[model samples]
Structures are given as C-alpha cells and as structure tokens.
Target chain A: MMNLSRRDTLRLGGVAIAALTIAPARARAETEALIKEFAGGKTPKNAGLTLDIPLAAENANAVPVTIRLDDRFSGARSCEEFLLVAERNPIPEACRFKFSPAMGMADVTTRIRLAESQTVVALARMSDGEILVRRVSVTVTVGGCNG
Target chain B: MLNRRTFIAAGAATVAAAPAIAAPVAVTSTTMLKPKGKKPRIVIAGGGWGGLSAARHLHAQGADAEVVVLERNPIFWSLPMSNKWLIDVLNTDYLLHDMIGPSRKYGYELVQTEVTGIERDKKIVRTSQGQIDYDFLIVAGGIRNGYDAWFGNDEKAIEFTRRAYPSGYTADAEHVAIKNKIHNFKGGTMVMTLPPPPHRCPPSPYERACVMAWYFKKNKIPAKIVILDPKPRIMPIGGGFKAAFDELYPDIIQHIPNAKVKEVDPFNKKIVTTAAEVKFDDAILMPPHQAADMVWRADLIGKTADGKPTTWAEIHPTMLHAKEDPNVYLVGDVMGAVSKQFGYYPKSAHVANYIGKIVAIYIAQRLKGQEVKTLLPDNLCYMMVSGEPKEAISVQFDYEIMPDGTISQKQIDIDIRSADLVEEDHKWAQRMYGDFLA
Candidate 1:
C-alpha cells in the first residue's frame, strides 16, 4: 500500500505518546520511594534470581510478571520469600508471595498494574540469608488505572 | 406508594408509577397537547433501551408533553440479548427491532438522524436534519469509545480498536464479525479483554467468556478462552462469575485478574498487557469507555479523583438529571459511576429502563407544576452465563436514600447459574420489552 516502514514508525510513535503521558516524573519518584521502603536499606545482589516480564506492553492495568529463583546457582538450602515491584505505580509493590521448604520451587506468576514505562524488580530471599534481585524494563502504551 | 424495600423484594416490580405486563400503548392524537401557548416538548437522544422507555412512559402517563426521539440507527439493536446472537443461539430478527414501527405506534416522532451538537443555551439539539428545540432533554446517548485514552488519538490505533477487536457492547455490525470469528475459529487462543470498572454491564465480559467457552466445548474445538481482567478480582456479580468458570468451563476458560491491556496491534492481531504479550486467533478488546461526545462538548463531564474529566455525564442520584444542566437528564451507560457516593448500581439495560421510567414520572409531575419527591429505584440485572437457554443469574438491589441524598444498599449475594432465576430472566426481559417497546 503506502510506505509500510513510515506507517510502522507512526504506529510506534502513537504507543510512545501513551507511555510518556502515563508515567511522568512524579510517578517515577513515587515508585522509587516505595522501592526504598521495601528494601529497608539492605543491598540487593544481582544474582540467584530471574525476572521474566514483558519489555513493552499494550495495556498498563494488567501486566504479566513471573519471578523464578536459581536454586542451583546460589548457596541457598530453600527459598523463603519473593516480592514483585513496579518502579512507578501509584502502589509500587505489586505483590508478595511466601514459599515453604515443602514447595521445593519458589516461582510465582501474576498480573500487576504499571503506571508507565519503568523497571520491574523481583527480589528473592533465600534461607541462607542471601537476597537476590533482578530488574526488567517495561513500556506501557495504554493506561488501565484511570480513576 | 411502594417503597424501595418492597420493590427490591418483588423481583419483577409493577409499581404505582410503572405498570408491568402492559402492551406498548400510544397516546392518541386527540390527547396530544394543542396548547394556546407554546407546547412543552421532551426530546430524548439515542433511542435505545433507556431513551425509548422514557418516551413510552411519558406517553403512558398521558402527559400533554410532546415527545421526540433522535436515534442514529435505522433499525434498533439491543446490547442485552445480542450476546446470544454472537454464539448463534439467537437470530438477527430477535436481536434487531423495527424502530419505525415503535415510533409510529407510540405516537412519538422518531428522527433517524445523528445528534451533532447540543445547544444548551438555546435548549435545542443541532442534528443532521436540523435544529430541534426542547423544553427538557433526556440524554441516554450511550458510551463513546475511549480510543484517545488508550492510544493518544492515533487514527490507526482507533481504527484497529473499532474494527479489529470488536467489543460487542453497542450491538453494531462488528458484533456479527465477532460471531463469525468465533464460529470459524480453528482452535487456538481466544483472548477476551475487559476494561476497568464502570464499563457497560460489568458481568458481560465474564458472561461472554463463559459462552465462548461453551461454544468451543460444544463444537469440540481445541481452544481456550483467556480473559485479561483489569480489576484484581471478579467485579459486580463477583463470586458468581468465578464459580461459573470453576464449575461449568474451568478447563476451557482461564481468567487473569489485574491484567490491564496496554497496547493493541490489530494489524498483527497482537495485544500487549502488563503481564504478557498474547497473539490471538480472535480477540474482543474492550477499550475504556466514556459518555457520548455530546456530553463532553456540552461541558457536562464531572472530574474524578485524578482531576481528569469523568468518562460519563455527572447526574444527581435522586433524579438522573445532569448536574451541569438540570434540564438535561442523563441515563443508562452514559451516566457516570455516581454509585461510589450515591449507591451501587451496575450499568445495565434493565437499570437504565428503570431510570427512564423514574425520569418520566418526574418530568410529568413537573409539567403539571406539582412537586415530585425524590425516588430510589432498585437496580435489577439478569446475566446469562451459558450458551444453553436456561443458565443465568438475577441480581436485585434495594437502597435507602439518606438525608444527605446519597444511597446505601444492602449486599445480596446469590449463587450462580440458577435455573429458576434464568426463567425469571427470560420473563423479565419479555415483560420489560413489552412495557417499553412491545
């Protein structure tokens, strides 16, 4: 038809506008504060965990996120707890999932609301007193949390 | 003189104001007001469920007020039973009605013209035909698709939203497309998305998913329905929807809560959510909804907590009249979610029909120069959860109008897929249609 490549760029531009308007600077700051509170000043190591989340999303309200712990890579007998965080949501903490030794694997999947294009962090706590972290960047084009 | 409590308890209410099981009655031409002075005219925009009810009720009350309805569609289609059409359980004849016959029989003038502008200062609606004056305006002009909210007024995005992913809320031609898509589906992922709350018929998406699941099962298709819900849990009917998924179609449908849609590429049939990017063989992508453009252009939209203008018209709960312009009344899905402060009422056709009657009584009383007391009509809803004719749930809500003018309702939870309620659902629809449209 018309110039296919130009049309594609225009389409991408539309999505970009949606992301920019949804997560302004103030929203990002709000999420950062929540992240600080959740961390409680403990330094999170970038090891022993994987955060599986979309790099970009069409809908802001329901983003699928998965957190998996690397039991073989680290010195952890068992996984105790896991936390999912959205860096710029009104409420940055998406959810908290607890795990027991009987479960064997510490993996959780759920949908979370994202205000804008921000980093999603997954934190996992091992029984051996180690905290592992992973971050994934997500760009949301349409907002779901319109009050 | 039936109060709110009695109205709710009596499932199918024929109150003092509205008589039930009545055939569609038209005001005789002899009874028409031929005033020595200017005749009082009531103009209802959007001749769908709510607008038609208000027009019919005004006629039934034997009011001297001249009633006129401005509807854009040539033939009337209902959002209520249209779902049955999508699953091939109901035909177009049942889904579509002759608007001309109803307008002529009811003695109300029906203009098959689009309402282009609302001239509030002059109390006239600027239509495609011409400017028509009115003494009172009833705005049942339903939802305007919130395409801007999703994709920043992108023409391609808006086009894709409307044509590619048919929401089937308006019962337009796209509804048939959705049905055809489902029927010809070759057994893969059928993605159905729900916008956040205050969308027309809260239980509809869940109902549609269950029905789609039934279609897949009945046809022996190897497909699954994935519902991406913007809310964290099942809303409005709540547990009833989840129970339907668990008991009837658990193997066929999977509901993911709090999964709001972020982006949709209709060209590629791809939808990206906060959770995952899903490619589907067929999809029903419902964008967020707003009141018709007339509500916004007339400066009738209210502000939300986020300081953004509301998607629907702001109206007083006691009488569904616009807060911005009292003479201009709003009903049906076009009315905002005032339930947060006023009371809990789902945006459904039945609730809208009830609101229309209440407005009619108020208008008639006012026309006679008599004071009309505040009224609280029960919000009644009957949702179909299965492809089978006899599987549905009926919800009834009663409210207490507080001294401050807000409503307080008692939560009545009923089990899902009740056969008795399903029978009531059919009877209720028939009587309701007979009461307003015959």
Candidate 2:
C-alpha cells in the first residue's frame, strides 16, 4: 500500500467528505432520469464504452475529452445520440453529440467545462437498440465554470 | 526655390559622380521603390508576435501602405500570459484573441493561407491558395517542433498534435495528456526536457516545472519534476528563475544541467542521458525546433554548420535580409540575429510591435526612393513565475548597433514581484495587444 503523508491524507479525506456531502438524492435521481432519457429506458452495458479524460484537470474551464465506442455502425444501425453529464456542474448536461453511420466512427473529441472534481458520464444510444455508458472521475483543482 | 524634381535630379547627379561616397544614397533608393498608386502593397507572412507587430506598426504610422497579413493559424496566442493557464490561474481563453478581427481593426488584410514557398527572384510568395506579390515581405511565421529522429523513428514516437488551445504553446490535447499523466503519477520521477537554444520562450520549461511542482505539492502528489537542460545555465532570465526555483519548489524539482536526452526507452519509461539513464513515470519532452515549414522551404533561411535550416535568418543591421533579396525582412524568433534568440530580448508582443514600426519606416523610406535607416529594436520580456501574482519579472533592453553592423544589448532588469510590477505587466499587455491587434 502506498503511504499517505499528513497533507495527502487530509486532501484525500476532504475530497471524500465533499463527495459524500454533495451526492444529493435529487442529483442522483436527475442523473438517473438523464441516463434513461438518453437510452430510451434501456440500460447500457459499460464494458464497450471508453472514456478518455484527464485524471486531474489543472483548469476546469476546458478539459479535453474523447469518447470512443466499440459498437459497430452497420447498415441502418448507428450511434444516433450521445450525452455528457457531470455530477457537480449546475447544468449537468455538459453537451450532446449526435452522429450517423455515414460519419464512419463513433468517436468524438471536444473540450468541455467542468464545475468541480467529480465523475463524468457519457451515455450513447445506438440504432440497434444498444446503450453504452462510460464514466471517468476527474479531479478539478480549480472550477472551470463561473470564473 | 528648389522643387521635388530638382532635388531628385541633384541626388541622381551626386550618386552618379561619387559612387563610393554616395553608396548609402544608392542603397536607399533601392529600398524606396515607390508604389504605382497612393498606397504601397505590403504582404506579410506569419501572424506570430513579429508579423502582428509589423502589421500594427504599419497601421499606426498611418503610412500609405495596403498591408496584407497571411497567417496559417486563425487565432493569435499570447506567450506571456500562457504560463497562467498551465498553473490553472487563467483559462486558455484568457490567452487567445481573434487575429482576424484585430487585423480588420488595424486596417490590414488577414488571409488564412499556408505559405508554400517564396520566389525571391520574382518577388512573389507562393501560397497554397495562389501567388501573392509584395513590394516588401515580412516573415514572422514563428517556429515548429522537429521531433523526427529524436526518439528512434518518427512513427514509433508519440506524434505531437497541436489543437486549437487558447495558449499556443500548450495545446488542448497535450495539456489533457500531461494533466492525466501527472495526476496518476505516484512516487516516481517526472522529466521535462528543454530543447536546445534559439527556441521560443527560453525560461518556459523551467517556469513550467515550477508550476507543476507547485501543483504536486498542493495535491500531495509524491513526484519530483526533474528538468533536463542542454544549456549550462537556466536560460534568458537565469538568475531570477534560479532564485525562484531554489526559494519555492526546491524539494519538488531536481535540476540536471549540461545534460541532453540521448535516447528514450519508451517501454521502461527511461531516458538515456549523457550523464545517466534516468527513469520516469511521465515525460514532457520538448524537442528541437526550427523555423516554420514555409521558412525552411524558402532559400532565405540561414543554414547551420551541419546544413540544417537553423531557425535564425541572417540579416543586415537594418533587419532586412542580408542577401537573396533586399525587399524581404525577418523578425522575432526567426531573425537569425543573436540578440533575438534570447527569450528576454523583446520577443514579447510589445517588442514585436516596436520592431514592426521600424520595419514599416524602412519600407516607407524605400518606397519614396530615399535611403533606408538602420533600426535599433527595444527588448522587453515579461514573465509570470507563480499564480500568487507577486512572482513576476520584466526585463527591458535597448539595442545598440555595433561597429561591425551587429547589435549589442543594454540590459535593464525590473522585478515585478511587487504590486506595482503586476499592474505594469497587465497594463503593458493591454496596451501592446490593443496596438498590435488594432
């Protein structure tokens, strides 16, 4: 096990306590509703969804993120809708990406605004009725929003 | 009463009689080729600090010159304020502004085009769009990373992709990778390699390490940022950077001087240096850089001893191209003059703006069939050491032309760590950017 110094322990404890205190029941329900709306009531398997984000973002204003899906976009079956949500942002829905089969890949790269250090979820719905979900926890030292 | 024609006839007669004594006059006439119309056609390539400064200066002089600036990048990135972005003090947006909008304000044409080559004989610049002719061409495209052959094969090495970040130095994609790599780092060495001299922002790598170490300490990340520099001393602002590094983040950073990265063992995260084989959890390698692709493609660039295109362009004391063509001039990082290489030497937008004014004067004199005058450029570089806003330093200098037509510097150091310096830096940035961008 890695040894945690006094400062490290305090920082970790502060982050953990903040997470516990901020994970309100309302936010959880809103996130659940968003996921459902994103997937049309279908729960997606998280295995095929790959989320690429920094473990820690120096500035919260613009964090580069890439969402890659392993699902194949064949004839009539494509990644139609994708949504990005952060647990801490006032506006939970950061952005939405819409794509079609003719666009080739189910990969998108962009810089999103993060409010705080929290888990970000990217949910995608395919034309074949398959839902994909990916989550990455980014520790934002300074909030990018409201600055 | 002597009219303008009589003065011209007398000048021509004097030039024809005493060629050696009137050499300066003849050279002046060549520079002062008047435009057919009221406004002279000036085409500038590269919208970096130098090119923007030239465009702004031409506009400020109120010269009858139709200035057209061709920059590959759509936006202008501020090098001075970029350090704040690395430390999370400033957003990327704070360091970037629209180059096109500023060009319009300055009454210059901003064309987004990739310069292919320059036909010096034909006095034409060949771009991807089409060939553009100019009475005078100012090249200020800035530098590009040459990572080919540094890490085994180019394909094997992680290709550097530049994304549109507010700060031009640190791209969005690169910052994401660096942040992720640094955060996940646990009790291992981290290396930040500095490229050889004549690169942009000399003290930047050291400043980067300072900020990174600050974050490491704040987050309690058990990692040390070891800086590998080829130069014997910390660059441009050597004393100030050394003082800050020692006084602030000494425990978090290990300095390795006179060392160059020989090879990289990517699988093991080990870099073979001239001194020793050091291993690291993450590495931020800044390879050697050269003039932009367009500059290297042109024959106007100065060559190194090994025949590679050195970022430096050899020029007359007046800052015009020494040979190949007299109408073309180089400024900023690519000027090939020794003083321009120093980061603290007026490489900032403020200084570039002044240099542009000098270039405009030279061009205007040449257009009027008059003698072109030698320019003495002012150097000013402002640096931000930390986010506390008190740890900034600004260096100012005035160039003195030497007997051999080279420029020697007269240096003035101002510590901006005080409250007054901070305000000065901000004011200077505002004033310079307004003038240049306008």
Candidate 3:
C-alpha cells in the first residue's frame, strides 16, 4: 500500500506535495462561470462567506459541505441564495439553498456528489447586489473498504 | 501487559526485542532531575521518560548513592505509541502504569509532588510538599504550552481554549477527552492542528489524524478531519505521510499546508491561521510550546544579557548540560538538541529515554571521580498509517558525535507501510516500557 522510494529526509515547516489527479482548465472555468451565473454574473468578494468542504472526498457519492455567512457581513449584505458547484462533476450545478434574513444566520450544511478531482465553489448573492464566495479543492479518490 | 512475571523476564525480552544500545557520551549533573547521592547528590526534576531513565540507571548501578525521583504525577503515562488511544475506544491501562513499581524496583525514593521552583543559587529544589537539596540537578520537566504568541495577555481566552479543545499532546486527561470525542463524534468536521517544529512527537498528530480518518471511514460517518499544519508539508517522514494522505485517506483527511494557527476563537469553534480562518465543529488546538516553567524561573532558557528569550533551554547538544551550569542538566523536550548535520533532534520518547540513560551515566562517573564519554542518542519512531489494514511506517536515526562537538547523523526511514511494522509498533512500546520499568 506504500512506496519506499528513499524519499527526502524530513524537514520542518513544510513537506512534499502529494500528486493528485487535477480537473482540466476548461472544466474549472465552466465551474467558475456557473458560480458567477448563480451570483447574477457578478464577481463575488472573498470576504463574506466561508465554504468549509473536505479537501478530499473519500466517498464522492455524498460529500458533506458547510457554507456559512460570516458574522462580519452586516444585514445590508444578507444573502438570498447560496449555490454550490462541483467543477469536475458531470453536472457542475450541485444545488442552491435559499436563505432569508428572518432565518437570522444565512447558512447551508449539506452533502453533494462529486466525480473526479475537482474544485468545490460556494457563492452567495447578497440583498445589496454584492456577491460573496469561497472555494475548496476536493481530491475525489477511492476511499477505504466501506467508504 | 507487563506484570510481575514480565518484569522478571524483561532482560531476556530486551535481548529478543532490541539489539544492544550503542556506547554513551555524557557529563555530570548536580541538582535537577533524579536522586543519586553519596559523594554527590544528583536530583532529577521530572518523572518523564528522561527522568525515569536516569533514575532507573543510577539506582540499579547502586552508584554508592541515595536515589530519589521527584515526579508530579502519581502514575506514569507512556507516550510511545499512545496515538492509538486517541482514535480507538480503549482503556488507558496500556498507556498508564503505577510509578511505584519502577520506583520500588529501582530503589529510587519517589516523591510525588509538583516542583514549584528551582533555586539554582542555593542548589535547592522547592516542591509543593517541601524543599530538597541537591549537588547536581537534572531539569527534565518537559515542555509548556507557549500560547502567549497566539493569545497574549488573554488569560480567559487561553483557559477557554485549553478546556474546549486541547491538543492532547502532553497531559493524560486531554487524551481521554479526545478519545471520548472521537468515540462519540456526532457529525461534521473535526480539526487537529500541528505545531511548528521542535514539538514533542513530530509525526504523532499526523498518525493520529490518519487513525481517526480510518475510524470515521470504517464507521461509515460522513465526517472530515481537517489537519491545519503550521508547516508547509508533512514533516520528518514527509513523503511517507504525504503518500498515506494521498492514497489511504485522501477523502477523509484535509491537510492545509502552511496554516500556522495565529488566533483561536474558542467559543465560536474557529481558529485563524496564517493561511486560512478555519471553523470547526470540534478541534484539537495544539498551542505553541516552550520549556517548562521551572526552567524559565531557573533562567535556563537562552536569553540576552537583558531579557530576550528563545523557547528551549540552551544546552550542550552532546552532554545535555545547560550551557551556563554543567551540574544542572536538561533533557527530553525541554532541551534544544540541535545537530550540526541535522536541525533539532527528533523529540521522541526513544531519544529521551536514550539521552536520559546517558545523562545518568555521566553523573555516576563524575560522582565516582571517573571520566565520562561524549555519546549521542539514537531515535526510532513508528507511526500507524491505517487501522483496517493495520499498517505502519517507521523512522530510525543513528547519531555520531564528532571531535569538534558537531553531531554526525545517519537516518533510516522505513517509509513503506505494512502490517508487520504495526506489529512492531506495539512490541516497541512494550519493550521500551519493560526496559525502564521492569
């Protein structure tokens, strides 16, 4: 299960990056475009929303992800819809969760299926025409016996 | 697993498990860690791996002295291979042992009390119970969490962080809390942070992460374990650990490189790192670490003529004696054992136990008016990579001390993960405990 190739001696503060099957450029661009379309064609700022997704999904069948509107985002930037997109999936659009200011905290915690190695992007369209976003890289690979 | 019979059988078992330890290089200590007094009283401060090694050796040789061990904990907690205790639902019997057995067997008086201060000027060790005098002191008190950099002047925040999410690297109670957290994980993401370098058990957090990932996956839980590493990559056996993350638990483990924990929001379950602000359902926060408080009071940490400081104690790499005081030795994670060929020495129990014995021998020789040699410690660390398949990886380091006082290093990494290595992992801990305690 392991390779003994006489790897580099251990160093501090950093280690070698493991190679992973990366999604194609075209697919990534399309995924970003889908995220943009969901944000009403506006580029989302990196600040307001946090998209917490697994760096790798053992079971791509149902990968759990959490999207939260940061408390720093005032009521003026309240999100209406939060869209999740998987770049390398056959269907890039996973689903969108509707949120309301009445809900107090606009957030979504759900699972979405992903195919090959891809990037998961979450976008939120605020009430004031401002958009917020976050992206996480999920390396979809074969999991353990059960996963 | 070591009962009375196993204690009697420890010698043969040592021969069966380990090849003979290499020659030792050491110098004398007077007042810090253990108890060997006749011509000279050698006081050891802590009852950790390093302290016990020195205590056992000094008393067993009957170095014509009264041997005593000043320990804080009533029981001894074995850290070697204790990572399994975090993920698997298991009793601590394997990791915990009665200190009385080793103390009685070795004929070292065990003082179970907290060390309040080390009065270096008077050569007196002030404990919670009382004060003890020493000719030489071994300050093997281990490391203290350096949370000042992260939460400066914020005692409430620090207290909250320690209670809510402990790194479980040092204390026995924290390990039990984390083990329960793993066993009864409700759902959502679990986070574990890796300290920068020179932390105790370099590969431990990684191995523990791997084991927990395997546990979550095996149990069919849709849980993700995010590893926020201060380092840019997995360290020590980097490639081997990286491979395990890539192949075995790629989906279950999220390793964010260069994510040094800068701020911790305990109430909100969030931590701001150099790279990202992470929000976790639960997290094991590994606060930055420095030598124990006793060392600071003793003025052992490297300091300018004024009062600037380094985290670890400044000690001779080979001799392990504090650069300022030859009689006051520092061992274990407390000392900065940097090598010329390598960087900081691996702060593993193997190295601690080995260096402890060496330090004791030096004190013994000095007590008898004999010369001491300059020997270095060898270290071997085993990490369990998976649980279902029961695979593990190991690393070995053999050191040589040059005439110039520079350390020459040789390392062998058994990077390949195998069931056989996992078997050795358990045996290694057993033999090590048997060696010192039995």
Candidate number of the best DockQ: 1
DockQ of each: 0.02, 0.01, 0.02
Q: Model 1: per-residue lDDT, tens digit, B147-167? A: 776789689878866887777
TM-score of chain A for the candidates in order shown: 0.68, 0.75, 0.73
Q: Which 10 consecutive positions of candidate 1 chain B have the poorest summed lDDT? A: B14-23
For every candidate, the chain B TM-score is: 0.87, 0.81, 0.88
**Candidate 3 per-residue C-alpha lDDT over B159-194 given as tens digits, one digit per residue, 9 for 90 to 100:** 888878877777568777787788788779998877
Please give the fraction of native interface contacts (Cα pairs under 8 Å between A and B) kept by each candidate. Answer: 0.00, 0.00, 0.00
Task: Show model 3 residue runs off by greater than 4 Å.
Answer: A1-147, B1-39, B304-307
Q: What fraction of the genuine interface contacts, i.e. the true contacts, does candidate 1 reproduce?
A: 0.00
* Predicted candidate 1 versus true structure: per-residue lDDT over A25-126, tens digit per residue: 776776656556655677779987989876865344556678988663334488878878776666667788888787888877666767667888888777
Binned by DockQ into CAPRI classes (incorrect, acceptable, medium, high), candidate 2 is incorrect
Per-residue lDDT tens digits for candidate 3, residues A1-147, read 222221112111122222243357767777767875776767779987898876865435446689998863466656788888877776678888887677877766766767666678888888888888888888864231101
| Prediction 1: B-chain TM-score | 0.87
